[model samples]
Target: MQDLAIWYEGTALAGALRGSGHLYMVVNAAHILGIGLLLGAIIPLDLRLVGIIRSGPIGIVGPFLSRTAGVGLCIALLTGGSLLSVSASEYLRNDAFRWKMALLGLGMLTIAAQHGGGRWRRAVETGVPDPRTRFLAALSLMVWLSVLLSGRWIGFL
Candidate 1:
């Protein structure tokens, strides 16, 4: 792992990012914007899934928000990977960073599970969310919140 980190840190992209403060700042800002996009879409969609908001139809809103969140995930991964490459060695050693990665994996898995089957479609068509759907929604929210918190803790730790 250390060797891998060393190689990552030695990459031209990483070196350039670390050498240029402005580029680093731009990437960091883009990462934040991606997070905002993710939360803005997922939270409201999850709220609806959990029956917190009943005014809107799930069939219409679910797919839209999910797509938006997907885009955000792509942006985040791109920028976050760049940021990580800049400090791979230090980040690999940080407990908070490890926790963030774990939580992020779990969050992505939860999202996949939630959207993988006909469950979402059925919930939308019937206008009734099953217990499992509700459970997944709550789990997703918790997982994402933990991921965000751990990511923040990375800076402090």
Candidate 2:
């Protein structure tokens, strides 16, 4: 796998990005900022969903938080893809990176599942209800935290 990664690193994609030092730095910064924004957006809503902010209307907070998360997701994807393009095959074999990617994927899917339909939106639009909403909140919290941890671990591993 290391040999394959080396080969891949020599390919046109990685080669194109190899000496782009400042660009890599910029991408790294953007990735960090994106992750920060994502967590900021989700954490409050997760708290609300868990019934901490039961008084407010769900429609107000949920959409705002969701949109903020969407923006973060877009930024993360753009910067992350740029970073990955410079070393795709190596990342593919990186266990921690693989887990980060998987968790990121799952977290996005979970968000989609929660807000994809009108009925689902309507149900939670007023703010999440008791039991189910709390469970969903916990899931959201866990997924994003895992993504963050695995992403950080990728650097060390």
- The local distance difference test score of each candidate is 0.91, 0.78
Candidate 2 has a TM-score of 0.82
lDDT of 2 at 127: 47
Model 1's TM-score against the true structure: 0.96
Q: Candidate 1, after superposition: displacement of residue 31 in Å?
A: 0.5
Off by over 4 Å in 2: 1-13, 53-56, 128-130
Q: Can you write out model 1's per-residue Cα lDDT over 12-108, one digit (the tens) per residue?
A: 9899998999999999999999988888899888899998888788888988988998888889989999999998999999999999999999999
Weakest 10 consecutive residues of candidate 1 by summed lDDT: 120-129
> What does candidate 2 score in Cα RMSD to the true structure?
2.9
Per-candidate clash tally: 0, 2
Pairs with steric clashes in candidate 1: none
Tell me each candidate's TM-score.
0.96, 0.82
